[model samples]
Target: MNTLAFDTCFGACSVAVTWATPEGPRGAFRFERLERGHAERLMPLIADAMSEAPFDFSALQRLVVTTGPGTFTGQRVGIAAARALSLATGAPVASLPSLAVMAHTAAHQLKGETAGKTLAAAVDARRGEIYVQFFSGPDLAALDEPLLTTPEDAARRLAGRDVVAVGSGSQLLADGARAKGLSISVRLATLEPDVRFVPEAAIPTDFGVPRPLYLRPPDAKPQDGASLARVS
Candidate 1:
Protein backbone atom coordinates (compact mmCIF):
# COMPACT_ATOMS: atom_id res chain seq x y z
CA MET A 1 0.00 0.00 0.00
CA ASN A 2 1.25 3.46 -0.93
CA THR A 3 0.07 6.13 1.48
CA LEU A 4 0.46 9.88 1.98
CA ALA A 5 -0.28 11.77 5.18
CA PHE A 6 0.18 15.36 6.34
CA ASP A 7 -0.72 17.67 9.19
CA THR A 8 -0.93 21.51 9.48
CA CYS A 9 -3.27 22.10 12.36
CA PHE A 10 -1.21 23.85 14.98
CA GLY A 11 2.41 25.06 15.11
CA ALA A 12 3.83 22.84 12.39
CA CYS A 13 3.60 21.43 8.86
CA SER A 14 4.68 17.84 8.10
CA VAL A 15 4.35 15.22 5.37
CA ALA A 16 4.80 11.46 5.32
CA VAL A 17 4.72 8.97 2.46
CA THR A 18 5.06 5.20 2.67
CA TRP A 19 5.14 2.64 -0.11
CA ALA A 20 5.61 -1.08 -0.34
CA THR A 21 8.47 -2.45 -2.37
CA PRO A 22 9.11 -6.16 -2.95
CA GLU A 23 11.32 -5.93 0.15
CA GLY A 24 9.15 -4.01 2.57
CA PRO A 25 7.52 -0.68 3.44
CA ARG A 26 9.70 2.30 2.58
CA GLY A 27 8.86 5.87 3.65
CA ALA A 28 9.79 9.54 3.50
CA PHE A 29 8.95 12.47 5.78
CA ARG A 30 9.34 16.22 6.43
CA PHE A 31 8.47 18.15 9.60
CA GLU A 32 8.78 21.88 10.04
CA ARG A 33 7.54 24.48 12.51
CA LEU A 34 5.99 27.66 11.09
CA GLU A 35 3.20 29.18 13.08
CA ARG A 36 2.19 31.76 10.44
CA GLY A 37 3.19 30.46 6.99
CA HIS A 38 1.82 26.94 6.69
CA ALA A 39 -0.12 27.71 3.52
CA GLU A 40 3.06 28.66 1.68
CA ARG A 41 5.32 25.98 3.15
CA LEU A 42 3.08 22.94 2.89
CA MET A 43 3.03 22.09 -0.81
CA PRO A 44 6.74 22.45 -1.39
CA LEU A 45 7.35 20.32 1.68
CA ILE A 46 5.06 17.67 0.22
CA ALA A 47 6.69 17.76 -3.19
CA ASP A 48 10.08 17.35 -1.60
CA ALA A 49 8.88 14.38 0.42
CA MET A 50 7.43 12.78 -2.69
CA SER A 51 10.72 13.28 -4.49
CA GLU A 52 12.62 11.65 -1.66
CA ALA A 53 10.29 8.70 -1.78
CA PRO A 54 10.90 8.57 -5.58
CA PHE A 55 7.18 8.28 -6.08
CA ASP A 56 4.51 10.28 -7.86
CA PHE A 57 1.26 11.61 -6.46
CA SER A 58 -0.51 9.19 -8.77
CA ALA A 59 1.07 6.39 -6.77
CA LEU A 60 -0.88 7.28 -3.67
CA GLN A 61 -3.49 4.74 -2.65
CA ARG A 62 -4.67 6.45 0.53
CA LEU A 63 -4.38 9.92 2.07
CA VAL A 64 -4.55 10.99 5.70
CA VAL A 65 -4.85 14.43 7.29
CA THR A 66 -5.77 16.17 10.49
CA THR A 67 -9.09 17.91 10.90
CA GLY A 68 -8.89 20.71 13.47
CA PRO A 69 -9.80 22.39 16.77
CA GLY A 70 -6.81 24.43 15.67
CA THR A 71 -6.05 27.82 14.17
CA PHE A 72 -8.75 28.75 11.68
CA THR A 73 -6.35 29.48 8.83
CA GLY A 74 -3.93 26.67 9.69
CA GLN A 75 -6.72 24.13 9.74
CA ARG A 76 -7.83 25.17 6.28
CA VAL A 77 -4.30 25.05 4.89
CA GLY A 78 -4.13 21.27 5.33
CA ILE A 79 -7.67 20.32 4.28
CA ALA A 80 -7.34 22.47 1.17
CA ALA A 81 -4.06 20.82 0.20
CA ALA A 82 -5.37 17.32 0.83
CA ARG A 83 -8.59 18.06 -1.07
CA ALA A 84 -6.75 19.50 -4.06
CA LEU A 85 -4.37 16.55 -4.15
CA SER A 86 -7.22 14.08 -3.94
CA LEU A 87 -8.94 15.81 -6.84
CA ALA A 88 -5.81 15.67 -8.96
CA THR A 89 -4.72 12.13 -8.05
CA GLY A 90 -8.05 10.37 -7.35
CA ALA A 91 -6.91 9.05 -3.97
CA PRO A 92 -9.41 8.98 -1.11
CA VAL A 93 -8.79 11.08 2.00
CA ALA A 94 -9.44 10.21 5.63
CA SER A 95 -9.52 12.66 8.56
CA LEU A 96 -8.60 12.53 12.23
CA PRO A 97 -8.87 15.20 14.85
CA SER A 98 -5.62 17.06 15.71
CA LEU A 99 -5.95 16.03 19.36
CA ALA A 100 -6.25 12.39 18.41
CA VAL A 101 -3.06 12.68 16.39
CA MET A 102 -1.39 14.08 19.48
CA ALA A 103 -2.57 11.07 21.42
CA HIS A 104 -0.96 8.84 18.83
CA THR A 105 2.28 10.75 19.18
CA ALA A 106 2.10 10.43 22.95
CA ALA A 107 1.57 6.72 22.58
CA HIS A 108 4.80 6.43 20.65
CA GLN A 109 6.98 8.84 22.59
CA LEU A 110 5.82 8.19 26.13
CA LYS A 111 5.71 4.41 25.54
CA GLY A 112 6.09 2.65 28.88
CA GLU A 113 5.41 5.79 30.90
CA THR A 114 1.83 5.74 29.68
CA ALA A 115 1.08 2.28 31.04
CA GLY A 116 -2.16 2.22 32.99
CA LYS A 117 -2.59 5.97 32.55
CA THR A 118 -4.98 7.89 30.37
CA LEU A 119 -3.64 9.95 27.48
CA ALA A 120 -4.68 13.59 27.68
CA ALA A 121 -4.03 15.50 24.48
CA ALA A 122 -4.57 19.25 24.53
CA VAL A 123 -4.09 22.28 22.31
CA ASP A 124 -3.76 25.78 23.68
CA ALA A 125 -6.87 27.44 22.25
CA ARG A 126 -5.93 30.69 23.98
CA ARG A 127 -8.53 32.84 25.74
CA GLY A 128 -7.94 30.53 28.71
CA GLU A 129 -9.43 27.57 26.91
CA ILE A 130 -8.08 24.22 25.67
CA TYR A 131 -8.96 21.78 22.92
CA VAL A 132 -8.68 18.31 24.44
CA GLN A 133 -9.44 14.60 24.17
CA PHE A 134 -8.77 11.61 26.40
CA PHE A 135 -7.51 8.17 25.35
CA SER A 136 -7.17 5.09 27.49
CA GLY A 137 -6.08 1.42 27.53
CA PRO A 138 -3.20 -0.32 25.80
CA ASP A 139 -4.25 0.47 22.28
CA LEU A 140 -4.92 4.06 23.33
CA ALA A 141 -8.47 4.21 22.07
CA ALA A 142 -10.16 7.59 22.51
CA LEU A 143 -12.48 7.70 25.51
CA ASP A 144 -14.73 10.42 24.18
CA GLU A 145 -15.19 13.14 21.60
CA PRO A 146 -12.80 16.05 21.34
CA LEU A 147 -13.95 19.21 23.09
CA LEU A 148 -13.23 22.90 23.68
CA THR A 149 -13.41 24.20 27.22
CA THR A 150 -11.59 26.13 29.93
CA PRO A 151 -8.45 24.55 31.37
CA GLU A 152 -10.10 24.19 34.75
CA ASP A 153 -13.07 22.54 33.16
CA ALA A 154 -10.83 20.18 31.25
CA ALA A 155 -9.08 19.33 34.47
CA ARG A 156 -12.43 18.57 36.08
CA ARG A 157 -13.41 16.46 33.10
CA LEU A 158 -10.57 14.06 33.82
CA ALA A 159 -12.54 12.87 36.83
CA GLY A 160 -9.42 12.55 39.04
CA ARG A 161 -7.81 9.94 36.83
CA ASP A 162 -4.08 9.96 36.31
CA VAL A 163 -3.29 11.21 32.86
CA VAL A 164 -0.23 11.90 30.75
CA ALA A 165 -1.03 15.20 29.04
CA VAL A 166 0.73 16.15 25.83
CA GLY A 167 0.64 19.28 23.63
CA SER A 168 1.01 23.09 23.84
CA GLY A 169 -1.89 23.34 26.28
CA SER A 170 -0.11 21.14 28.83
CA GLN A 171 0.90 23.89 31.20
CA LEU A 172 -2.53 25.42 31.30
CA LEU A 173 -4.07 22.05 32.06
CA ALA A 174 -1.39 21.40 34.64
CA ASP A 175 -2.07 24.72 36.34
CA GLY A 176 -5.78 24.13 36.29
CA ALA A 177 -5.29 20.70 37.78
CA ARG A 178 -3.14 22.18 40.48
CA ALA A 179 -5.75 24.75 41.36
CA LYS A 180 -8.41 22.09 41.50
CA GLY A 181 -6.33 19.63 43.53
CA LEU A 182 -6.19 17.30 40.56
CA SER A 183 -2.83 16.50 38.99
CA ILE A 184 -1.46 15.31 35.66
CA SER A 185 2.01 14.59 34.34
CA VAL A 186 2.93 16.53 31.23
CA ARG A 187 5.15 15.15 28.41
CA LEU A 188 6.15 16.32 24.95
CA ALA A 189 4.17 19.40 25.92
CA THR A 190 5.87 21.49 23.26
CA LEU A 191 5.41 18.95 20.48
CA GLU A 192 3.42 19.58 17.31
CA PRO A 193 1.62 16.99 15.20
CA ASP A 194 3.87 14.89 12.98
CA VAL A 195 2.51 13.46 9.75
CA ARG A 196 4.63 10.38 10.33
CA PHE A 197 2.36 9.30 13.18
CA VAL A 198 -1.19 10.38 12.24
CA PRO A 199 -2.77 7.14 13.51
CA GLU A 200 -2.78 4.30 10.93
CA ALA A 201 -6.55 3.84 10.98
CA ALA A 202 -6.84 7.54 10.17
CA ILE A 203 -5.98 6.68 6.58
CA PRO A 204 -8.22 3.71 5.92
CA THR A 205 -8.76 2.55 2.37
CA ASP A 206 -12.50 3.23 2.35
CA PHE A 207 -12.18 6.94 3.09
CA GLY A 208 -14.20 10.10 2.62
CA VAL A 209 -12.78 13.49 1.75
CA PRO A 210 -11.18 15.30 4.68
CA ARG A 211 -12.73 18.49 6.14
CA PRO A 212 -11.78 21.16 8.62
CA LEU A 213 -12.75 20.60 12.26
CA TYR A 214 -12.82 24.12 13.66
CA LEU A 215 -14.61 23.85 16.98
CA ARG A 216 -15.65 27.47 17.35
CA PRO A 217 -16.81 30.28 15.10
CA PRO A 218 -13.98 32.13 13.41
CA ASP A 219 -12.51 35.14 15.14
CA ALA A 220 -12.85 37.13 11.95
CA LYS A 221 -16.38 38.34 11.40
CA PRO A 222 -17.80 40.77 8.85
CA GLN A 223 -17.61 44.30 10.16
CA ASP A 224 -20.80 45.15 12.01
CA GLY A 225 -23.05 47.46 9.94
CA ALA A 226 -20.15 48.16 7.63
CA SER A 227 -21.29 46.40 4.50
CA LEU A 228 -22.31 48.46 1.49
CA ALA A 229 -25.84 47.78 0.21
CA ARG A 230 -26.01 45.15 -2.53
CA VAL A 231 -27.46 46.42 -5.83
CA SER A 232 -29.51 44.22 -8.11
Candidate 2:
Protein backbone atom coordinates (compact mmCIF):
# COMPACT_ATOMS: atom_id res chain seq x y z
CA MET A 1 0.00 0.00 0.00
CA ASN A 2 1.10 3.54 -0.70
CA THR A 3 0.54 4.98 2.75
CA LEU A 4 1.33 8.18 4.56
CA ALA A 5 1.11 8.74 8.32
CA PHE A 6 1.77 11.57 10.74
CA ASP A 7 1.43 12.46 14.42
CA THR A 8 1.17 15.76 16.33
CA CYS A 9 -0.39 14.41 19.46
CA PHE A 10 2.03 15.67 22.08
CA GLY A 11 5.33 17.52 22.17
CA ALA A 12 6.39 16.79 18.58
CA CYS A 13 5.33 16.75 14.94
CA SER A 14 6.30 13.89 12.60
CA VAL A 15 5.34 12.45 9.21
CA ALA A 16 6.07 9.26 7.29
CA VAL A 17 5.37 8.06 3.74
CA THR A 18 5.92 4.61 2.31
CA TRP A 19 5.15 2.67 -0.83
CA ALA A 20 5.63 -0.85 -2.06
CA THR A 21 8.13 -1.61 -4.81
CA PRO A 22 9.50 -4.76 -6.39
CA GLU A 23 12.77 -4.15 -4.59
CA GLY A 24 11.13 -3.62 -1.23
CA PRO A 25 9.25 -0.98 0.75
CA ARG A 26 10.58 2.58 0.44
CA GLY A 27 9.74 5.44 2.81
CA ALA A 28 10.83 8.68 4.43
CA PHE A 29 9.78 10.73 7.47
CA ARG A 30 10.56 13.89 9.43
CA PHE A 31 10.38 14.10 13.23
CA GLU A 32 11.08 16.98 15.61
CA ARG A 33 10.19 17.92 19.18
CA LEU A 34 9.11 21.55 19.39
CA GLU A 35 6.48 21.17 22.15
CA ARG A 36 4.31 23.70 20.33
CA GLY A 37 3.67 25.16 16.86
CA HIS A 38 2.35 21.84 15.60
CA ALA A 39 -0.16 23.57 13.30
CA GLU A 40 2.62 25.47 11.56
CA ARG A 41 5.03 22.54 11.46
CA LEU A 42 2.77 19.66 10.43
CA MET A 43 2.10 20.44 6.76
CA PRO A 44 5.68 21.25 5.94
CA LEU A 45 6.85 18.08 7.63
CA ILE A 46 4.38 16.10 5.55
CA ALA A 47 5.52 17.80 2.37
CA ASP A 48 9.14 17.22 3.24
CA ALA A 49 8.53 13.52 3.97
CA MET A 50 6.61 12.92 0.76
CA SER A 51 9.13 14.88 -1.27
CA GLU A 52 11.99 12.65 -0.13
CA ALA A 53 10.32 9.71 -1.79
CA PRO A 54 9.14 12.11 -4.51
CA PHE A 55 5.62 10.74 -4.53
CA ASP A 56 2.52 12.74 -5.37
CA PHE A 57 -0.28 13.20 -2.86
CA SER A 58 -2.63 11.88 -5.53
CA ALA A 59 -0.87 8.56 -5.42
CA LEU A 60 -1.53 7.94 -1.76
CA GLN A 61 -3.78 4.96 -1.14
CA ARG A 62 -4.11 5.45 2.61
CA LEU A 63 -3.70 8.23 5.15
CA VAL A 64 -3.15 7.93 8.92
CA VAL A 65 -3.04 10.38 11.80
CA THR A 66 -2.91 10.09 15.57
CA THR A 67 -6.08 11.23 17.24
CA GLY A 68 -5.13 11.85 20.83
CA PRO A 69 -5.49 12.01 24.51
CA GLY A 70 -2.95 14.81 24.13
CA THR A 71 -2.76 18.55 23.96
CA PHE A 72 -5.98 20.03 22.56
CA THR A 73 -4.05 21.93 19.91
CA GLY A 74 -1.76 19.08 18.86
CA GLN A 75 -4.53 16.57 18.22
CA ARG A 76 -6.44 18.99 16.00
CA VAL A 77 -3.35 19.91 13.98
CA GLY A 78 -2.62 16.37 12.85
CA ILE A 79 -6.24 15.53 12.15
CA ALA A 80 -6.79 18.68 10.09
CA ALA A 81 -3.81 17.90 7.90
CA ALA A 82 -4.93 14.32 7.37
CA ARG A 83 -8.44 15.48 6.54
CA ALA A 84 -7.21 17.98 3.97
CA LEU A 85 -4.94 15.43 2.36
CA SER A 86 -7.63 12.79 2.34
CA LEU A 87 -10.09 15.23 0.78
CA ALA A 88 -7.63 16.10 -1.96
CA THR A 89 -6.46 12.61 -2.74
CA GLY A 90 -9.47 10.39 -1.96
CA ALA A 91 -7.31 8.28 0.33
CA PRO A 92 -9.12 6.89 3.37
CA VAL A 93 -7.93 8.16 6.71
CA ALA A 94 -7.24 5.85 9.65
CA SER A 95 -7.22 7.33 13.13
CA LEU A 96 -4.89 5.76 15.71
CA PRO A 97 -3.99 6.69 19.27
CA SER A 98 -0.67 8.45 19.92
CA LEU A 99 0.02 6.31 22.98
CA ALA A 100 -0.50 3.20 20.87
CA VAL A 101 2.11 4.46 18.42
CA MET A 102 4.52 5.00 21.29
CA ALA A 103 3.87 1.52 22.59
CA HIS A 104 4.23 -0.05 19.17
CA THR A 105 7.54 1.72 18.64
CA ALA A 106 8.74 0.62 22.04
CA ALA A 107 7.71 -2.95 21.41
CA HIS A 108 9.75 -3.07 18.24
CA GLN A 109 12.77 -1.25 19.63
CA LEU A 110 12.94 -2.84 23.08
CA LYS A 111 11.61 -6.29 22.31
CA GLY A 112 13.92 -8.02 24.79
CA GLU A 113 13.10 -5.95 27.86
CA THR A 114 9.35 -5.97 27.11
CA ALA A 115 9.19 -9.76 26.68
CA GLY A 116 7.04 -10.84 29.63
CA LYS A 117 6.05 -7.60 31.27
CA THR A 118 2.87 -5.71 30.58
CA LEU A 119 3.37 -2.73 28.22
CA ALA A 120 2.10 0.60 29.41
CA ALA A 121 2.03 3.73 27.26
CA ALA A 122 2.06 6.79 29.48
CA VAL A 123 2.03 10.36 28.16
CA ASP A 124 2.45 13.27 30.54
CA ALA A 125 -0.92 15.00 30.38
CA ARG A 126 0.24 17.73 32.72
CA ARG A 127 -1.50 19.13 35.82
CA GLY A 128 -0.33 16.15 37.91
CA GLU A 129 -2.06 13.71 35.59
CA ILE A 130 -1.15 11.35 32.75
CA TYR A 131 -2.76 9.74 29.76
CA VAL A 132 -2.25 5.99 30.10
CA GLN A 133 -3.16 2.76 28.34
CA PHE A 134 -2.12 -0.82 28.98
CA PHE A 135 -1.25 -3.71 26.67
CA SER A 136 -0.55 -7.22 27.82
CA GLY A 137 0.42 -10.74 26.69
CA PRO A 138 2.27 -11.81 23.52
CA ASP A 139 0.11 -10.15 20.92
CA LEU A 140 0.33 -6.93 22.91
CA ALA A 141 -3.43 -6.69 22.96
CA ALA A 142 -4.68 -3.51 24.57
CA LEU A 143 -6.02 -4.26 28.06
CA ASP A 144 -8.11 -1.11 28.09
CA GLU A 145 -8.87 2.07 26.19
CA PRO A 146 -6.65 5.11 26.62
CA LEU A 147 -7.24 6.76 29.97
CA LEU A 148 -6.57 10.18 31.50
CA THR A 149 -5.83 9.99 35.21
CA THR A 150 -3.26 10.61 37.89
CA PRO A 151 -0.09 8.51 37.81
CA GLU A 152 -1.12 6.92 41.10
CA ASP A 153 -4.43 5.83 39.65
CA ALA A 154 -2.75 4.49 36.56
CA ALA A 155 -0.24 2.50 38.62
CA ARG A 156 -3.07 1.02 40.66
CA ARG A 157 -4.85 0.08 37.45
CA LEU A 158 -1.86 -2.12 36.58
CA ALA A 159 -2.91 -4.39 39.47
CA GLY A 160 0.62 -4.53 40.99
CA ARG A 161 2.09 -6.47 38.08
CA ASP A 162 5.56 -5.99 36.62
CA VAL A 163 5.31 -3.49 33.78
CA VAL A 164 7.51 -1.86 31.17
CA ALA A 165 6.30 1.69 30.54
CA VAL A 166 7.19 4.19 27.84
CA GLY A 167 6.69 7.95 27.28
CA SER A 168 7.23 11.22 29.15
CA GLY A 169 4.97 10.16 32.01
CA SER A 170 6.80 6.88 32.69
CA GLN A 171 8.81 8.22 35.60
CA LEU A 172 5.70 9.45 37.38
CA LEU A 173 4.02 6.10 36.93
CA ALA A 174 7.22 4.37 38.03
CA ASP A 175 7.34 6.38 41.24
CA GLY A 176 3.74 5.63 42.00
CA ALA A 177 4.20 1.94 41.24
CA ARG A 178 7.20 1.75 43.55
CA ALA A 179 5.20 3.34 46.35
CA LYS A 180 2.80 0.46 46.00
CA GLY A 181 5.54 -2.20 45.89
CA LEU A 182 5.00 -2.98 42.20
CA SER A 183 7.81 -3.16 39.66
CA ILE A 184 7.81 -0.72 36.76
CA SER A 185 10.63 -0.06 34.31
CA VAL A 186 10.74 3.21 32.46
CA ARG A 187 11.85 3.49 28.82
CA LEU A 188 11.79 6.43 26.41
CA ALA A 189 11.13 8.80 29.29
CA THR A 190 10.71 11.80 27.03
CA LEU A 191 8.95 10.02 24.22
CA GLU A 192 6.26 11.34 21.92
CA PRO A 193 4.42 9.34 19.32
CA ASP A 194 7.02 7.63 17.10
CA VAL A 195 5.78 8.54 13.61
CA ARG A 196 7.51 5.54 12.07
CA PHE A 197 5.03 3.27 13.79
CA VAL A 198 1.94 5.45 13.31
CA PRO A 199 0.76 3.28 10.47
CA GLU A 200 1.60 0.04 12.23
CA ALA A 201 -0.34 1.12 15.29
CA ALA A 202 -3.50 1.56 13.25
CA ILE A 203 -3.58 -2.16 12.53
CA PRO A 204 -4.88 -2.75 16.04
CA THR A 205 -7.51 -0.02 16.07
CA ASP A 206 -10.67 0.96 14.27
CA PHE A 207 -10.38 3.32 11.29
CA GLY A 208 -12.45 6.35 10.35
CA VAL A 209 -12.26 10.06 9.67
CA PRO A 210 -10.05 11.54 12.35
CA ARG A 211 -11.56 13.16 15.42
CA PRO A 212 -9.97 14.66 18.51
CA LEU A 213 -9.76 11.93 21.18
CA TYR A 214 -10.00 14.30 24.12
CA LEU A 215 -10.04 12.03 27.17
CA ARG A 216 -11.35 14.88 29.28
CA PRO A 217 -12.79 18.34 28.68
CA PRO A 218 -10.34 21.06 27.76
CA ASP A 219 -8.94 23.00 30.70
CA ALA A 220 -9.78 26.33 29.20
CA LYS A 221 -13.38 27.25 29.85
CA PRO A 222 -15.32 30.31 28.82
CA GLN A 223 -15.11 32.93 31.52
CA ASP A 224 -18.30 34.71 32.46
CA GLY A 225 -18.51 38.49 32.71
CA ALA A 226 -17.85 38.54 36.48
CA SER A 227 -14.82 36.27 36.16
CA LEU A 228 -13.51 38.26 33.21
CA ALA A 229 -13.91 41.48 35.16
CA ARG A 230 -12.05 39.99 38.12
CA VAL A 231 -9.14 39.01 35.90
CA SER A 232 -9.14 42.40 34.27
Q: Evaluated with lDDT, which candidate comes out highest?
A: 1
TM-score of each: 0.92, 0.90
Q: Which portions of model 2 show Cα errors greater than 4 Å?
A: 198-206, 225-232
Instruction: Judge candidate 2 against the unseen true structure and give its global Cα lDDT, from 0 to 1.
Output: 0.83
Off by over 4 Å in 1: 202-206, 226-232
Q: lDDT score of model 1? A: 0.85
Clashes of each: 0, 0
lDDT of 1 by residue, 49-146 (tens): 89987668887887888888788888899999989999999988888788877787778887789989988899898888999989898777889888
